[model samples]
Target: MTTAETTGGTTAGVLAARQRSAELEELIRKDPGRFRVLTGDRPTGRLHLGHYFGTLHNRVRLQELGVETFLIIADYQVLTDRDVAERLDEYVEDLVLDYLAAGIDPERTTIFAHSAVPALNQLLLPFLSLVSVAELGRNPTVKDEIAQSRQSAVSGLMFTYPAHQAADILFCKANLVPVGQDQLPHLELTRTIARRFNDRYGNGAAPVFPEPDALLSAAPLLLGTDGAKMSKSRGNAVSLAATADETARLIRGAKTDPERHITYDPAARPEVSSLVLLAALCLGRDPRDVAADIGDKGAAALKATVTEAVNEHLAPIRDRRARYAQDLGYVRRILRDGNEIANEVAQATLDDVRAAMKTLY
Candidate 1:
């Protein structure tokens, strides 16, 4: 989806995007400085390669830079469009293991499930009042989600996910949010809601929340083996839990163009380009460079190369995930400890919000 479709056909994204600096990413690269960041993913399943290079990898890097990072396992977000009533616990557990396997340190980063943070959810009640149905419906990100989920009757929760996201961002008082090109509109909505809340209620002394800026990642959009969007629900994604043989089989079966000579033109050959992007991510090289290396090599060679590179890269992650899976007790403890820390921060933010609005009575 373009900015037109993603930003709800408004200039809100174009305007708010001015503050989102690629320079900030460069700055972080050079100095490794500290900033408070709030970023997360819905606990639908084990994160795939789309996640590793997209967001989860960035989360680990940010934490290592001493930046105060909060990783939210948005378990509640799963219910926004679909029902995970039976598999919610299994989903949450697998997500936590994926976090650990991907190197998200529980000691350094507070990785809490959204449902575990009651105070955070409570903040959503007041935040819901701050944004209207029109405003929420106009959210391009939400609209795109509703469309993708194929839900004709949009749920109230799905409609107001941006507001819930605003609550998530503001509750942590985050100043930097690491996101991709697709998430800019949602982040812009968070900024709008934060400014709206502060202007209305925090005009007296101090603003309660700082509008967070997008810390753009270096990775591009990763497509699944089928050259479509990488998603578990679609059954096209390469799971982080996939063994070497499984990964190889998936890559071997991936879609590629009929061209005899491989090239990296996403518009012309999206299938090959998707594999090119994946290769670049796995080996940390330019996609164009990878394309050149596969010169004269046919589709078979291209798939073989991608299969080898991906398996080599994900081997350690899969191993670590297996180790974490064995110790479910340890994983539960990590979540519990993270919940305590997250609650403290969330409750403090909610208390401040109540006091600012004078709704504490």
Candidate 2:
């Protein structure tokens, strides 16, 4: 696991994190104008609990707040690391279901796939010029991903996905990105690219791109049960679509320290800390506070608490997911409409980009 995964705690612990949250809240609350927001997930597989506590919950909240949000199903990005073309559609569709199940309203938030927006690929051409190879290599997120890849060497597409991500955000003129605290670096890189493009090509006129701010989540991303990251490959993830009994079974079988006292000391008690992290995120309390409350409690009680809280959080989502799954055609239509919206938004941005570069015929 990377340092980000190891440091399993909420953002409330830090002063700068609080300031950033305040700034983002001010933007979300006080700013009357429509704020363009962009965010998404890769179509690797079904999203898990880590996804909810980390990012998806924020997406739902922002859209409810009336932000003009665009949620991308980054289908093409799935090809970056793995050759899963045959199963791409399956993963993408399941990802959409998870998004909708998580309360992302199709009427309010435009949800589209990366492969559907052809023009989105064009933005990467010029965006690729704004950064250096060294900069891409230096991206902490990318480095972490590359380090974690099973493949011996990172592919070119994998290396340049950040540039593609910039295209994902800038193409829609997203001025704010909802991200975890660990993802602040990637957003900073996007800001740098936007700044570079405006400085070089805008010629002291209207800036073509917005310097997007990172709307950081107050909760830290939860790790897998085994103290590793919460990913499918690790087999440590609990899916959003998992049955209640299945969830309980997984939590029951999860690892814990032999000492059995539920403390939030991540360094000494990583496995137990991970459960505490999950419970704290679910209950909206500090991990230390949670640890103190459950002091000297055995692992059985801790596991039961995490399982119950997680199930409570997932109950509504499961209800919505079942209803949405009943009519597959309706879900497809929502994705199609979202595809059109994404295409239109992307084309307009492409036109503006061509005009700024004087490349339009």
Candidate 3:
């Protein structure tokens, strides 16, 4: 289904669904929770609104709710696309800056580079052995990614990305894995590994891995200017770091319907529909309502209005990002402290995992 349909459906179910999720999340929040959270970004490019709305924003919310948040810099995953491998350092730093700029509060969130955590990688071996080749191949995420890449020969790492993700979550003993609807399959695999390890070693004493549930986000998907998926690689994404002029230029260049008059009909007029959606998100109003307010205003006027709204929304974030960027020391200190906390928790989990598997030396 299109994002519009998904948004509409979510709006219908949101009241009850959000109540349940929030209640459960609050339970996890109040206690000195054993329920750890594992969520991250692949360091292929700087993050954009899609990243913000889809996950990062929720991560901030989760942190405030008191879940121990581990933000993984999936640096290794960058190798999935060959072109990105050469620029790994630049990309990793940009990812860090983006996270800091987006109000992640490194003080509250544990941020670490995937490659820096060796013990986590070590867990991959025993974790990998628990799942079969057939099981990995059956994962819908792997299948979709393969189809998207159009590659006949997939990397073992790419095919076993779920396992790596399992290692990421299991290494932190994460009880909650916040994911989009599309990511349920990978979370299922993580749960399987957790259960298997607990059954093998826990001897019914205590659960080693908490089977994580999907903390499905209720946020609307933000489309790119051209009405496709908002991805940095697609050249359609609006970066969090974009200057006012750049944002205005991009919004001005955004595709709109030929109707001249503004209306929000996603199916028939995706371009203008996308603009309306963006305006709503920025202004915190319903897209339909925003369109009605526009009345007979031309698309040009609508785009100009949206451009101003977007810039206004992003200006403070951009300014904050600029300050953090100037002081690399502050950024480093934040990540360093986060990494220390992450490693401490990860080490405990890995120790338990090793003892459970009898891999301890």
Q: Best candidate, TM-score-wise?
A: 1
Query: Per-residue lDDT tens digits of candidate 3, residues 1-361?
Result: 2121222124533343344456666676677255678899887788888887778788877777777788999888776644337678777778888887878877678899888777888888888888899988888888878777734566777777889999988788776777766676677688787778777788767887787655667767677988788888888978998888988888888887778668888888887888888888888988999898887888878988888888998888898889888988777777677777767877887888777767789
Q: Mark the regions of model 3 whose C-alpha exceeds 4 Å error after superposition.
A: 1-34, 150-152
Q: What are the lDDT scores of the predictions, listed in order?
A: 0.82, 0.83, 0.78
| Per-residue lDDT value at 296 in model 1 | 85
Q: What is the TM-score of each candidate against the true structure?
A: 0.92, 0.89, 0.89
Q: Candidate 1 lDDT, tens digit per residue, 1-361? A: 2222235234565444434455666667676545788888887777798888888888898888878888898888887887444488998898899899999999899989898899999878878887788988877777777887756676778887888898888888998888766777778778777877889998677899887777656667778887788887888989899888888889888988778798999888888999988887898888899999998888888888898889988989989999989999999999999999999999999999989889889
In candidate 1, which residue pairs get closer than 3 Å at backbone N, Cα or C atoms, i.e. clash?
Answer: 8-140
Please identify model 1 stretches exceeding 4 Å from their true place: 1-19, 26-34, 150-152
| Count of steric clashes across candidates, in order | 1, 0, 0
Greater-TM-score candidate between 1 and 3: 1
Cα lDDT for residue 101, model 1? 95
Clashing pairs in 3: none
Candidate 2 lDDT tens digits, 190-221: 78788888888897899999988666677565
Model 2 ranges with Cα > 4 A deviation: 1-18, 283-297
What's the lDDT for residue 164 in model 3? 90
Clashing pairs in 2: none
Whole-model alpha-carbon lDDT for candidate 2: 0.83
Please give the lDDT score at residue 187 for candidate 3.
75
